[model samples]
Target: MIKWIIFDAMGVIFIVGDDTNDLLVPFIQGHNKRILKKTINEVYLRASLGQITSRQFWQEVGLGAQYPQIETVYLDTQLILDDGFTSVARMMSKQYSLALLSNDVSEWSAYLRNRFAMDFLDVFVISGDIHCRKPDLNIYKRFLKEAGTQAGECVFIDDRCKNLAVAKSMGFKTIYFVRQPKKSDFVPDASITSFNELENAIENICQQIIERVIFY
Candidate 1:
């Protein structure tokens, strides 16, 4: 039985702009998306893992001189809680353990916690705290250990197919959240575009699992 529901923070619980584009990309004058993406990716893991401060990260990208201004723009970036998902999470907390597993920088994560009320969450496995990001087997193992639950007893929901694929391989039921589906080798057990479909998808999965157990 699924005793826990693990949620990804960025695209799932919190809406960060219209898409997952980098917050600083647009604010940077004369920016090249390709080079910017490459540069950010190079240092993103280390920054998310809390090995360096956000200022240090921008410095590595050669934006150290404009770090303060970029930081202001980044902070001003639109980010809001998905009310529908928050409501669902609140309701689900009564029946199942609810957790947040996110890849985020330490300073921003702290800012989010202070800005939002997350009392309904039973566990929070943040990459900044653990120094490991998703799609990394170690992070998932850490979440399992912290939550005190087996992989089979959890349902993992993420907006990225790659992340879901990793969770599925680790034996956790996976759900992919996206607006328009594209072809992918990593098939999710369920795909949802809106928060409205989430509850039903989860229910259907649980029902199917129960039926299989009964049959065998």
Candidate 2:
């Protein structure tokens, strides 16, 4: 039975517009712009797992070079939806322990910390402070150990399949977040496009928890 729930921040809880790509990678040639060798997925993995510094992560993508001029635009790109906060907070509070595990930049993350009273969370693991990123195994392991919860007792939800795969291998039940069909490849216990879907999933999972206890 799940007693705790963890979430990935960027795609799952917030939506960044197409301009994110432009802000992240600003260089363009006369006709074509260079593509990133390491996808955002890879960057996030490294960041969340604490494998690289924020500077190092952005430098690899050529964005670090122009960080000074574009920093504001880059940091301001993130948008936190009111509906998402209402949904996730409603389901995860009181009944279940909730944590946010995210790979994020220090400056911007601090901004969010002030904007939202995420103190409601039982725990929050952010890459910038810890110098660890996701899919590294260590971060997840540390989170579980420090969170004092067993893998089977927790559910991890992320927008990427690879991230979910890693979480599953570590014994977490995972949900892959899809923006459109609300489903993805790895058969999440539940997949949702909007935060509002979290209430139903939480209720359903808690019911299963009750059933299991009763049967046992």
What would you estimate as the lDDT of candidate 1?
0.79
Task: Give RMSD to native, each candidate.
Answer: 3.0, 4.4
Pairs that collide in candidate 1 are: none
Candidate 1: list runs displaced more than 4 Å. Answer: 16-20, 28-37, 58-73
TM-score of structure candidate 2? 0.71
Q: Which window of 10 residues has the lowest lDDT sum in candidate 1? A: 17-26
Q: What are the per-model numbers of colliding residue pairs?
A: 0, 10
Q: Write the per-residue lDDT of candidate 2 for residues 93-188, one digit (tens) a residue.
A: 778898888777665566675666677678887776677667677778878877998988888878777778888887787776675443445666
- Candidate 2 regions off by >4 Å? 17-23, 26-70, 78-82, 181-185, 212-216
lDDT of 1 by residue, 1-216 (tens): 989999898878776522325454454423434456556665767888989988897787677888767665565565667778777888889889998889988777667666677788888888888888888999999999999999989999998888888899989999888844667888888888778898888888899889989999
For model 1, what is the alpha-carbon lDDT of residue 61? Answer: 69
